[model samples]
Target: MASICLGRQPILDRNHNLVAFELLFRQEETEETAHVTSDLSASANVIVNAYGKFGIHNVLGHQRGFINADPDLILSDIISLLPSKHIVLEVKESASITLEFLQRCKELKQKGYQFALDNIVAINSQVELLLPLVSVVKIDVLALTRNQLTQLVNQLNHWPVLLLALKVENQEQEAHCRQLGFQMFQGYYFAKPEVMSIKRADPGKIPLLKLLALVMQDNDQNSDIDEIEKEFKHQPGLSYNLLRMVNSGSDGLPLKINSIKQAVQLMGRKQLQKWIQLLLYTSSQSADSLSDEITQTAVTRGKLMELIARAERPHDKNHHERAYMVGILSLLDQLLGIEMQQIVNKLGISDDMNQALLNRQGRLGQALKLIEAKEKGETASIPSLLSELDFLSLNELSDIETQVRGWTDHTDATVN
Candidate 1:
């Protein structure tokens, strides 16, 4: 019953936001035969060669995706799997971008495919030669020195290639890279994906459970709106959580609800009860007794972030799931005060999401790290994270931050 999750990745729009997203995805490939440690790769050739629609519809369609492949894999399957007009093909650094590969890439470009050079650098002669063919260039910033970096920055400014500063270790590096003009970034400084364990009675779920209990204890299928408000007010955070959830969506409600009573009226009692119970069981809070505020905060953050991710990536991709996973994971310790891996074990999250959560060695992990950094008020690292997610406009980024903060404030006030 493993479920694919967003992990701790940051979900960005054309602007970067602390969005809720399905940053990671997976198949129940645990045949015990599907090695737990296989070298991951992109199979673009499967797309081109395949007659029908690319299978990327369900698999590898997470908010942030990573695929690694050697020359042979790309030369053979990658060309086919590449949907050209959509999706990205990241050529592994292990491959030599010989003229032949470049020629093939050129042909693909003519057909509308986009390409990225993974872990690129100065000595990566093949990438340098094919710079014109690439849409994005990811550099392992950890390995580059100030001087080497200077050369790349100076040389790339004139190119159309988007520079991704990968493995940016800290806020200082993020700042320096922004000053040097890198487009996106990745690193450990962003929130590290953590695996936590939680129990049903854990304090994390107290608020949610309390709300649930109160609602259930007064089992009137049609409780008065004021009574419902009283229930939420009894707990410190419930009203705010409702406001945050409603406001998070694209069809922003016309009137802002400042209290739980209004929210109860807005959503009939039946709907409110169902959602509250659902929120209680969601990954946001442990399956324990709940507080009004913590429970509502988890729900508010998860729903709000998900709305942001879904809006930015309107396609059928699982961006919402990614966004929610990160939002919940970010607040897990605060709500539960438990170790992370334990949480993963208790939940039904799939292996790939676990990789992003536990290892932070992949693409989704990097994105999550970025979101964590921004949320912590580290503005300098914003650029690098955006680069990792892709090119982002400052205005969109601002909107996202504003939305999250607004939701946070709204949720707090309503709940308090």
Candidate 2:
């Protein structure tokens, strides 16, 4: 199955506790357009993949799922498939709130479904019709001025619906919304992206590179446990993070792993490789150059490309792993502030991955293109880009995103 990238933006209640997650699906392509041929399919794909591949709890944890629904998706039996108690069906602003559509919503409401109005900009007749049916109204806090925000809140006061502020960018905006009596908030304000400068790789990175090389070695016969231990000893910080992660109860080890040797033996080469790769991505210490956001993007790209490679060539484990390497290393130039060729030469990665990183020529390179497109929110261009590879679909791509997000979150929790 092709792995898709699923992103969840947290929605918080008045007390700042996570109450729900808006399920977002991103497909990678090279184009920069937002026009998709089928909003219904996109919506349905998100619901299907969120419920099917990743499972609701994996994506949303214990919080409710806020899914956007088009008019067609609203009418379909797919809405009935979702657990009513765990989801709040969001009415898309573009959805024509005709009498028939409202009737269907009412039917679902009678069946114990909840609704939210997305992108509320005005108090129009259609919005007025949906106001009573929806339990929450999501207003774009960034798009509206203070006066407009106040006017919208004042207009909605007649209804018992809760106000949910979207696109809140900072504490100031969040506080402003709270002052305006908005009961819920959503945005990237909490963990803002850090600006990383172009600097030479740190001295500590040398040991990490050595450990990475040892772990990524193709041979199984050579017992390099002692050498690996030496590398960890050389870098105490990496060792500490490694031990902290192993003992964090995230690995589910029967006994506490106190030493690097114990970890290496128990984790094996493949698992160890994965763990080290994750560590390289998440390390925020002075030695690690990449910011959390950049690392997250790289990790997500690696996972999505790996899933795509798996779908294309199911029997080729090497290709799958290499595809993942391509994804993670695709952004190495930006992360390390080094030339792509120089970076690849230092890492000793495969020619295919090297070519993909530098020129985007091979299959892995094409996969990277899609990942870039998804990162750029170019969903409409993905289909055309992948026209040669018919096995991949937009929904499947989206599903992979969800899976990766869960994996990233789980890894972060474990490492932290």
Cα lDDT of all candidates, in order? Answer: 0.49, 0.67
The residue-by-residue lDDT of candidate 2 on 1-416, one tens digit each, is 23343456778888889888887644432222233444444455465446433445556666788887766567543465466777898885543445657788999999889999998888877787788789999998888898999998998988989999988898989888889899998887853222111222222444555677777756553467877887878776566545543433222233466778886675567656755553343332123434545655665677788889988999999998899888877876676566878766666677787789999878888878887877787879899877756678878877776545432323334211
lDDT of 1 by residue, 1-416 (tens): 22222222332222344322112222222211121121221122122111111123222333333344334334332244333433456675433345555666687777777667777667456556667877877777888888888788787777888877777778777777777877666556654332111111221355554454445343464564555567567654445446543432213123566666666666554445555544444433223333435543544455445645665576735656666655555456555666667655544355544665677534456555655565467889878776776734556666655544422223223310
Report the C-alpha displacement of residue 267, candidate 2, in angstroms.
38
Give the least accurate 10-residue stretch of model 2, judged by summed lDDT.
192-201
How much does candidate 2 score in TM-score?
0.45
Task: Report the Cα lDDT for candidate 2.
Answer: 0.67
Best by lDDT: 2
RMSD to the true structure for each prediction, in A, is 22.5, 14.5
Lowest summed lDDT across 10 adjacent residues in model 1 is found at 45-54
Q: Model 1 RMSD to the real structure?
A: 22.5
Q: Residue 388: error of model 2 in Å?
A: 43
